[model samples]
Target: MIEIKEITAEETYPLRHEVMYPNHPFEYIKLPKDQEGKHFAVVNNAKNVTVVSLFFENDNAQFRKLATLESEQGKGYASKLLDFIIAYAKTKNAKKLWCNARVNKTNYYKKFGLKETHKTYTEAGIDFIILEMDLI
Candidate 1:
């Protein structure tokens, strides 16, 4: 079984470092106001954290540094985690939940009802498009 639960930012660093920022410095995975953001992870029956996502702010929750173990991808863990985060954001009275999704991954976010916004940006040689879901 996969268990999704809240965790400290520090606990998520390892997975984020390995899956999201492997070529960059360890600190590259760390975002500002990280402690203020609520972190969550999907732990498998083997007790390994296979997915990580961070949700921050109340009225406008933002997801960042979402990463899943390479070996564990495509098993629906990320989708499950996204489902949980959506419910969680609702509880926090968020009007919207947004993320900077990689160009290639926009379809994945679209599956969760997130629409692409006009905003665009680039980082580390990769382009990102803004995707957001209205909570109300």
Candidate 2:
């Protein structure tokens, strides 16, 4: 079963390292899970990974990292996470939502009304464009 829950700061330490190391290393977003950021993990039985989300509230709450485990990719887990975050942001009264969506996945964000706001940029060896969705 896949469950999404908020992770404590301590709980995210290892996961953060795992995500931002080797293949998917991202240092800018690595943060203590409990330090105002929300860490949502989609875990299944027997401790296999499904997905993870790391984001925080701001003038506009951002969907920072919506990551699906390598084994669980292309199964709509990312879509579900996006839907969940959109609904959660609505509850928080966010004015807008934004992400630096990977170029390959630009179409996905477009489906959710996120318009690309910037030209392509490279970060951590990945190509992406900034996309924003208006909450109001």
Candidate 3:
């Protein structure tokens, strides 16, 4: 069985670093606004965190640092977690839900109904595009 629940920003660091920034320093995975965002994780039956994501709300809701353990990929954990975030954002009445998605992963996010905008950028040598789903 797997469970999804709110976790601390610090609790998200390890998975984020391991999956998203393995070559970068530990502190590189720490978001500056972590303290102001809500964090969540997916824990497997073994009680090990396999997926992590951080969300922030303003006029629109934005999610960042979404990562899944390399060993746990292709099992639908990230999809489930993203569904939960979308539902949670809707409950808050956000106008939209967005993320800075890795360019290569844009197709994966499109499966979740997120559309890419004209916005694109390169950060840490990785190309990213702004993806958003209208909520209202």
Off by over 4 Å in 1: 46-48
Query: What are the RMSDs of all candidates, in order?
Result: 1.3, 3.2, 1.3
lDDT ranking from best candidate downward: 3, 1, 2
* lDDT of candidate 1 at residue 134, scale 0 to 100: 96
Ranking by TM-score: 3, 1, 2
Per-residue C-alpha lDDT of model 3 across residues 13-124, encoded as one tens digit per residue: 8888988999999999998888988888888975545555546557688999888888888988899899999988898888899999999999999999999999999999
Model 1, 13-85: lDDT tens per residue?
Answer: 8898998779999999887788888888888985545555556564799988888889888888888899999
- Top candidate, metric lDDT: 3
Clashing pairs in 2: 20-25
* True-structure lDDT of candidate 1: 0.86
Instruction: List per-prediction Cα lDDT, in the order shown.
Output: 0.86, 0.68, 0.86
Candidate with the larger lDDT of 1 and 3: 3
What total of clashing residue pairs does each candidate reach?
A: 0, 1, 0
Q: Name every residue pair that clashes in candidate 1.
A: none
